[model samples]
Target: MTSAAPTTHIVFPLYPGVTHLDFCGPHQVFARLPGVHLSVASEGGRDIEAEGLVFAGLEDLATITHCNVLCVPGGFGCVEAMERPGFMAAIRRLAGSADYVTSVCTGSLILAAAGLLEGRHAACHWAWRHMLTEFAAIPDEGRVVNDGNIWTGGGVTAGIDFALALVARIAGVGVAQTIQLALEYAPAPPFDSGRPDLAPETVVNGYREKLADVLRDREAAIRRVAAGRANRASQ
Candidate 1:
């Protein structure tokens, strides 16, 4: 008799103001994985509004104790999410037993706040990647960075690439390729301005200017989180 394939439980913890693409892109990829059981949960099992869309019927993250993989998605509410004691505690608990700890975009910041990314290399949005250093995590410019069992994706769309890489690791390159084909994951952007280096100076500067206020706020929040972590460690 043949043995049944073991299930891989993948959990995604959601919060308000989350960027839909950050989780949706990866969710689509992971859903295609064989023997994968995906769960989307929020702090209180309540509905979440993200980028104008409402995600309903979510499981409470506090109720989930274990998972094979934990993928945290990023959004504008990330700084606030990092500050939530319950949210951070749940993250630490889930990551403690997860076979793989991962994040998309600014979600890496949450992992760092949870004390999971220290001494590891991670990827985040180009605008905020430098903040990872504050948490003792080396920020990488790669679209997807894998350091040990920690996987992080750069920005929003990169979540798809990150998920595909993780799928390759969990299953096999052939299986990942098959799924890529099934989804027709091909990219041919009309512009060559995806990265800071590739983007025109004016565009980059304009974007930086536009993000200045939020960036300042995020930095302040990260500093507080880092300081608190340092204090806890010292105590």
Candidate 2:
């Protein structure tokens, strides 16, 4: 009799203010895989509300010391999360022991803050792609980027694509494709405004103007976290 393959263990750290789709999009793809165990982690295992922006599920931090794959998702609350005591440290601890470290959207920034993405090529939301450099990461374009055991996704919906790619890498193309087909993952948006280049100038400029303050704050937050990581490294 052949021995069964060891189950692939996956965990995603959940926190208040995590974007709903950022966590769920990729989550759905991974949940479809066979012989995979998944869980969501939050501080104290408390209910998470995504900072009231989206109705993400409730989860608490996993007590496990390590996992096969660990993921982090991003949202407006990331800035606050960066300022949260012991959060990045916990992430650093988990990523250090994980076989694979992954992130979605600005979540890569969080991973960077945790010192996981340093010296790694990764992907992030287009709006914040440049910020990856603060943590010594090389930025790439498109929906997904794979650099060794570190995988990252761009924006929100890209999580789905990233997870599918990760699944193919772990299992097989056939398995991932079957999951995609089962989910009917085909997407056809009515508008061509997903990216700034494709969107009308007015729409693009308006959003940029509106988000300038938020981006500035995010930059400041990154600097603070980067400093903290550097301090710990030198210690």
Candidate 3:
């Protein structure tokens, strides 16, 4: 008789304002993996409201002692999430023992804020990618980036691709391909404006303008966090 394969525990650390797709896309992919145990956790094991959706009954991040993977999802609340002492502490602790440290979109920023992405290449949403520099992280323009055991995906939709890549890494290309086929993961966007480089200048500018206020607030928050981290390091 053959012994069972070791179970892979994958944990997703969530906070309010998270883009549902950021974690849900990957969650769907990982759920199909054989011998995988998945957990969606929050700082307090409380219900989280995101983009008008409510997620309840979450495990507390502090309660999970160990996991094979630690995947953080990005969202509008990421800056606030990074500022939370308990949340950041839990992230640092779990990442310290995780076989893989990963993030989707601005989630990479959270990892950077946790001091996990220093000097590492990471990926994030285009609008906020530059912010990674504040944390000493090099931002990559790739939809998915892998540096050592740290893997990061670009904006929302990229999480699926990132998950597939991770599945391939953890399981095998064959398994990843099987899952993709099963899910019918073929994507064909109706417009060529998914990326700034491909979109019309006016469209890009308009989107940037719309984001200006939020960007300013996020920038301020990140700077404060970065300064705090620097001060702590010097002490």
Candidate 4:
């Protein structure tokens, strides 16, 4: 099924520590859309490996002259991306010009840093929700949020929901519903620990422990990124 648009470039900004689900989920949904072009972009057309899977065919950020849609995937390396002048510049430039800009997980942080989240209600991984405040973003707890042209999704798997919602918004409810039905989007979690509100105390504690480790590492990287940004600003 071909889309009405001649071409829709869906850009994925790649970096280390990127969650495989973030890109894969959305890619699955977007690929089904007609006439949609997908590009996995990086600082340079360099090869990037996500969770041990090597991607050697990724394009450089500069190759995206214009985009209909931009999909930013989240990872541990967002701080590094935020600090890179060329990287941040590419995001700010391209995403600013994009008709629609969307992000998954902590990728929202990158968008926030690029000053694209102002006055937009966005969502991100609950573990990192507070960080959006640093960028003057109104954070929501939903799995996905669509605020004007900006679309944001919570952690990893939530990207599927976000992408499906975007499909419905752009293509129509019929298209989204069709895809959802084909993909068996019916989700029945074995346990009710998906969110803290529904999880048992022990399950929530375990999730917290896992998040604490990530927070520690993220905090250190964030400080370095902040310093780098400040340095660039001063220069």
State every prediction's TM-score relative to the real structure.
0.98, 0.93, 0.99, 0.90
- Backbone clashes for every candidate come to 0, 5, 0, 1
> Which pairs of residues clash in candidate 4, taking residues 3 or more apart in a chain or in different chains?
3-34
Q: Alpha carbon lDDT of residue 86, candidate 2? A: 69
Q: Which lDDT tens digits does candidate 1 get at residues 88-121?
A: 9999999999999999999999999899999999
Candidate 3 residue 79 Cα shift, in angstroms, is 0.2
| Sliding window of 10 residues with minimal summed lDDT for model 4 | 222-231
Please identify model 4 stretches exceeding 4 Å from their true place.
1-5, 220-235
Better of 2 and 3 by lDDT: 3
Error of 1 at 45 (Å): 0.6
- 82-162: candidate 4 lDDT, tens digit per residue: 877788888888887798999999999889888788767889888887787666689999999989899999988899999
Q: After superposition, which runs of candidate 1 have C-alpha atoms over 4 Å from their true positions?
A: none
**Which order, best to worst by lDDT?**
3, 1, 2, 4
Q: What 10-residue stretch in candidate 3 is worst by lDDT?
A: 43-52
Q: What lDDT does each candidate get?
A: 0.95, 0.86, 0.96, 0.84
TM-score of candidate 1 against the unseen true structure:
0.98
